[model samples]
Target: MTAPQQGSDAKSNDSSSFVTFSLAEETYAIDVLQVQEVLKVTEIAPVPGVPNYILGIINLRGDVVTVIDGRRRMGLPDQAPTDQSRIVIIDVDNQNVGILVDSVAEVVQIPSKSIDPAPAVGNDQSSRFILGVYSSSDGLTILISLEKLLSDEEWELVRNI
Candidate 1:
């Protein structure tokens, strides 16, 4: 699987590239390989009846892509989008998905040995999505696995939208 390959690649290379972003004041990151692109806040056409985290859809070169609010997905209270807000397009389940973040931070190389397993303290819902925790110069950045971010049922809902 890609997750294991990603780990092995990190171990072999000594570091892995990650695209970092802010969500609810905490820094979080995802493997650079999964990132398609990053965009500024755009007008997202809201879809009815989907989960609250599913912000809506956007036209990306004629492709309708679902955008998810990272904060809402993490069970955090909603906040107003600011000038720094961004939409990070990533590949999930072989489909392109966008994750809205407070801001898109610079990509950085994190050492494989610096990554710690996800702590057991968080609630199950939150912990499941966390791949690991890396202590960086800025602070701790939680690495997320998009594949685990949603369940089969949830992916079905997103697919239907």
Candidate 2:
């Protein structure tokens, strides 16, 4: 795995940066700092008795990284990935895992003024994984909270498997 490159303005407090990606038909973004790298989908070794959403584990430059299928985690039906599928490597609570996305969009700068709190009811589970919503010219992009998305329990299970 490649080490994270320190931004030139590392000392600056920036809340507008985000790395966007696609899942099914929806576009989402997460704090760019939370992202470790972007990789191609690779072969994974299955671990029996684990949740279906947990695809399996893959060797990432000598590091065994667990892979999570975002669609399945969100209660969506399983579907084959297209040419655009990507593995978004993220560091959650110091554990590295790769989340399978339909495709990666782009890195965007979302000003604080453009972000709004997630709705309370309609998107319960999805909202739990979200930090905020950013409205852009293209459309709405859900900003994900990586630490909350992959809490300790989730990582512990992956680590044990």
Candidate 3:
């Protein structure tokens, strides 16, 4: 089924919106524009020969979406799935990919001024995906760059899927 862009028309004309979610006890976020939909944990059919980060694929309506274990992708210790687990569908290069988050948090608006460049954390691949960090009363939230999340080889694999 086609993912509905719920409340899609309500996006702002000036400010930026982000969909926050938890991963490995830390809060993270992605641009709202890239979010297609949010779904509960569903049965995934594992595909062989793929990276460990890729758990498998799930059939959403008629479309098959690749599911990525967000924790594993971030090099965090593996945790069993729970009731609050959610698959956040996002558009990466126009393709929808599911990020398995521990729990999805509420969306928030962070103006350009509030977004600070991510400090260098060596040259790790995961660190490269961090766009910036936002601070508020709730504490620090890391913003992820979905565009750079996967490497070219990984993207090529996704492309050939």
Candidate 4:
């Protein structure tokens, strides 16, 4: 959660830049400013006493970053890492954490007007984390809130680590 790239409210802007990524079979996005880096699937050192979503830790240069199994966090079925697998480093609160995504897609600029609330699609609980749906030339992209990626209790646990 680095202070510089705290996730902001996307609903308040006329236009927003999002870094899109793929998870499971769906496409998703987050504020571009919140993204610190995107890395390929790399070796992660496991941490004890953490939840299942935590894959492990990675030493980024000198900083130790906590890697999260984003699919698990979002309640999606787990799949083995492939060549397209990526670790998206996001800044939330004042710490930087890594979200393991299936693939890192292109960045997209979407107008706020084109974004709408998440629809009740088959009662998917993971949809709770989705902030809105952005309509683009390709299709609709689900926009997520990075700050809301982890719960308060989860944040506390990460802070302790």
Candidate 5:
């Protein structure tokens, strides 16, 4: 919850920067501007009666931030946290939320023209959150829309948590 990088320079007219991270062995990115800061996996105080995706809450400075398990949210199996695991605090719906990622890669700046629209695939709940895709030399990076990461009802539940 502390002010680290404001990410003011994460966007431009010709291109947009992204904060890339790994999840379920796949690469995913979020608009860099939405990223507040990254923190190492810490002791999470688990809450009862919440959904499985809600890993629990963390005492980030004086703020009680809800940490969501990215794997669970994406319908992927859960894995134990490793040394590379991190909590990526992102700006979602005007509030700071933490997304547990496998490992953070890097901040990549991709040209606007290079970004491709999300493919028209079968109706999948997770697919709705995909903003676009970027094929880089390393591989393809799935860009996600944090706003759609959760439904209005889900957001309300998180707020109540």
Candidate 6:
């Protein structure tokens, strides 16, 4: 999909608008339409028999939202956040979940010209989660394929619950 264009008022933009955030030293972004809200770091209840990367569930406004440790999912060593951690609440496959990010960054307008297709080389699993790379003044933002990121098996489990 091509990046969306914007008018004078930003709020009226299309679903392609993206909210960027930081994880470790790298930057990433997801379609703004996919993001429900951004929340502060909160307690998560552990779920047994689930993957370790799945950091359990969080209670958000009376709704149980699964929390995923993004760093762990990327094969990075875990480190406790020091006042900079944030939870980006996103809806994937009709399920609301919180992705633990290092910090929340600004929402940027990534034109179609700035986004490049995901590289076919390197780790296949990682590539599957990425949709494209958006170049910006700050740095490159890895645009995530939210639908694909939560694989079919995972979505089925969440849906069944």
Model 1 ranges off by over 4 Å:
1-13
Q: Alpha carbon lDDT of residue 154, candidate 6?
A: 58
Who is ahead in TM-score, 4 or 5?
5
Taking the tens digit of each residue's C-alpha lDDT, what string does model 5 give over 45-73? 99987878899999889998999999888
Lowest lDDT block of 10, candidate 5: 1-10
Q: After superposition, how far is residue 141 of candidate 6 from its true place, in Å?
A: 1.1
List, residue by residue over 17-104, the lDDT tens digit for candidate 3. 8999998889999999999999999999998888888999999888889999998888788998899999999988778899999999
Instruction: For each candidate in turn, give its C-alpha RMSD to the true structure in angstroms.
Output: 5.3, 6.1, 6.9, 7.0, 6.5, 5.0
Clashing pairs in 6: none
TM of each candidate vs. truth: 0.88, 0.85, 0.87, 0.86, 0.88, 0.83
lDDT of prediction 5: 0.87
TM-score of 4: 0.86
Worst 10 residues of 1 by lDDT: 1-10
How far residue 64's Cα lies from its native spot in candidate 5, in Å, is 0.5
lDDT of each prediction vs. the true structure? 0.87, 0.80, 0.85, 0.84, 0.87, 0.79
- Pairs in steric clash, model 5: none
Candidate number that wins on TM-score, 1 or 2: 1
> How well does candidate 6 match the true structure, expressed as C-alpha RMSD?
5.0
Q: Give the TM-score of candidate 3.
A: 0.87
Error of 3 at 72 (Å): 1.1
Segments of candidate 2 deviating more than 4 angstroms:
1-14, 152-155
* Alpha carbon lDDT at 66, candidate 6: 88
- State the lDDT of candidate 1 residue by residue for 38-78, as single tens digits: 99999999998888889899999999999988988887778
